[model samples]
Target chain A: MKQRLRPILWLLLREYLEHRRLWALAIGLGLAIIALDLALSLGGQAPAGGLHVMYHSTRALESVSGNRTGTHMIGSLAALGGYDLLLNTIAVLFALTLAVALFSYGLACLYDERRDRSLLFWKSLPISDAQCVAAKAITGLAVLPLVYAVTGLTTVWAAWAINIGLPMTAGPTPPMTAARLVGFSALVLGVLPVYAISLTPGLGWLMLCSAAVRRHPAIIALGMPLLCALLNVFGLPNPIWHWVAAPLVPAGVGHALQSIEAGQAPATALAWVYQPMSQPDPWGGVILGLAFLAAATYCRRRHAVLA
Target chain B: MSESDIVIRARGVSQRFAGRPALTEIDLAVPAHRVVGLIGPNGAGKTTLINRLLGLLVGPGTIRVLGLDPARERHALMQQICFIADVATLPRWLRVAEAIRLMVRLHPGFSAAVCETLLANTDIPRRAHIGQLSKGMVAQLHLVLVLAVDARLLVLDEPTLGLDLLNRRRFYDRLLEHGRSGQRTLLITTHDVAEIEPILTDVIFLDRGRKVLDSSMDALAERFVEVVVPPAVLTEARTLEPCAERCVRDGYALIFDRSRGRDLSAIERLATARNHPTLADLFVAFRTQSNA
Candidate 1:
């Protein structure tokens, strides 16, 4: 297994070295954003009095915003930006972009093998097809996340430093609440599966497309979804049409039209998107992601077209 | 060779591309510890045949490598079989050393020492990025990677295609030195047949997606003949032998598979036989024969 992992590690290292420039950009931009946000808050306005006004007046604003205790702002500014909406927005978009970057990195990882024709080099090795495919999946699922997490933590600290150094009454204090830290950590962890879920389907499709069509994979990548959309536009009664339309239609609206005959209260919309993670299975996405990875590996091994 | 001595036995192998036949009813046997050269022009199904043996393609028949079906036992087959296409490709971001290390790590039988030795005398800096290297250096790196594996069968598809004359000669020399141990088998496909003829033990000519001829180099050298005749005698020479006649400035040349002993008395009466038909001449004869 160690022997099988060497090439994967080599590829990972190669990517890291190639995109080292991105690291500089990420840290530099992160620090710049941190400094600018801190400076804006410090320069925004000032308190009318000293410590009494600082503590009591801050509480007044907190109660008005519907939080009896406004510890949310400390973690918010330290971790995410100021507003709760902004926090969630940044959290989601950050996760989304991270996933996209990972997906693109995965694509380019395989792309290098094809463009350089070094895929033959990997194929020629004694490693099994599963090992090769697994290496790719592992890099995507494990290594990329590890790098992102490390970079994320580093940037968080830089943000903390910038906020603390600036002259602000509500600057980051030393004793952070354990609940806040734990809550924010849980939220960040919660976003992981979102990244995984977003990535798996696209990767699964790419794997199948790459194996089935040896040439012009990019064409298939862009064309397959567009073709499905066209089928929907043409009134093709495909399963994908229902899957898409089911999410778009409000159940109340559709039910009200049907209920004119029966005349009852409009039916409640069963929101598929709002399925709570605390429900039946929280790890469903994780399991599905793994299943997709397995399918991809199996397809890669059995299909001779990739050769 | 003994039955156990055969490394690759391909029987009734057929391959198609988009429902068009690339190879049909192909039968081939490659013995262990011998250098077998696959000679052909472009699109002669050489790559198709190699791909089949590597289990990269499957069709109507079976191919056995190392006594195991390559498709069913790719892991076992790959452990003993190393393949290199003539085109040079390695990750551009990798240093030459890193590529070697990766190969060493992945291939169970890879020899890091051999790879190190192969690059010892060359200017292939271990730390240099593969993209920065010249084409010949990249080819050299690929060869080093393949040769380090303790494989019984080494399949090289036109492994010197883009190499300059010096690098090409060096490649042949290094490859011959590696094969001199007489412990490994090599199957090579190349348009440059003459360049490889000196080291090849056996040769197979693939023309128009079919195997036209397969024989030992010595047997071929003894059988095929090229006759040189005065230019005016060329027309009469054509009727005497089922051969390809070409007009040289000073004299005319005719290449024929004289192993069948086609009547050549009329041509003998007019002209004398040249030294021998080289592999190139045999290639030309096969192409012309297939076309005819």
Candidate 2:
């Protein structure tokens, strides 16, 4: 088992080395966005009206709250709500960037090698073609997303630190705690597996097109579904569009983020992440994705770079 | 070579592209410890046959290299086979050291120390990308990488294409010096047949997807004789049925099949001079006869 796995692990390492620049770009862009956000929020003062509203809301809550328990609950909820809004917005942006990067990367992973005639050299090695395709799939589905998640977690922490230092309001600082950081980390981590599972079909399709198409794989990958949608005008069912959009829509990710922000128990948030797996649509998507993966392997085995 | 000595065996191996046959019923056997040359013109399926042997293409017959089915057990077959398809097969973006490292990691037969020593003889830097190097340097680097492997069979298709005469000479010299150790087999295909003829132990001529000739070098020398006949006796030499004839400065240079039981002493008496035919001469004769 060790001997069989060693070469596969090396193939994966080769993939990472070949495309590490994409990871750098993703991480660098994430940091730049965080830095720019910090510069803007810290360099500028809160508008007078916004500060006035915060002060008035705090005073109103304090005066009406004769019950300590009620006031504390309201304060905690407000704090949690504020953190959720800020963190979820950052998560959404990061997720969007990652989606674009990973989509483009996956589409080009197999295609570029053939285009450049490098596939011949790679095929000359002892590793099987299935192993080669699997390495690319893992790079796109797992490795790239993990890079984004780590960077996203770091950006979230940096933003939280910046918020603590910057005076966002004239009133007392909103309740802040390390638990907010833990919750944000948990949320990103939980959402990533769901995102990976849901996107498997789409990722597999991209790789399959990359392996099968001789020219303009990206256009084919995007245009085929568009053509399918156009065919729907004649009353044909548009399952292709649905398969392409099922993971890209990110409804499950949003739901998990919202649940975590609502101060739901961690177990409940995690359950929301796994909820998509139990759905009929996602199950179908998984089957279709697996079929695509198998096709991709076949195409890769038949592919010749110089031909 | 005996059957047990055969490392590559193909029976009725045929390939086609879109109903156009590239190779038709190719039956071949490659014995170990021999330098075999697969000589052919363009479109004769030299690369196609090599691809089949490497298990890169699956076609209409059975092929076994080192007792493993190329189609079903490519990973295992590749462990003992190394191929240099062309100079451009190496990725242009890979640095020299990275290429070596990748091979060392994936190929248990790869010897990094041998690769380093070979590269040290060239000007290729460890940090230089393949695209940054000259064509000759790329070929050299490729040769270095392949030679570092302790594979049993090495297949090269146009391995020295586009190289200068000096680099090509040095490439083949180093290849012969290191790659062939009496236990390793080499199957090479190239258009420069004259240059490669001296090292070939056996030659196979392929034309239009058909094997025109397959003979060991020693048998080739004994089977065919090139005789320069005087114009006075040209008619007598014609009776021997030479495979090909051409007018030279001295006389009519004819290539005759001595294995036809013709009296060579009689032919020698009629000839001004007689000698063995070169591989190039045999190739031309075979191609001309096939065309006719």
Interface RMSD of each: 3.3, 1.3
Give the top-scoring candidate (lDDT).
Answer: 2
Per model, state how many residue pairs clash: 0, 0
Candidate 1 lDDT (Cα, 0 to 1): 0.64
Candidate 2, residues A232-274, lDDT tens digits: the string is 9999999987876656654556666567666776667777668
Choose the strongest candidate by DockQ. Answer: 2
Q: What DockQ do you compute for every candidate structure?
A: 0.40, 0.51
Cα RMSD of predicted structure 1: 9.5
Off by over 4 Å in 1: A1-96, A109-112, A165-179, A186-199, A206-307, B231-242, B248-250, B262-273
TM-score of 2: 0.88
Backbone clashes (count) for model 1:
0
TM-score of chain A of 2: 0.81
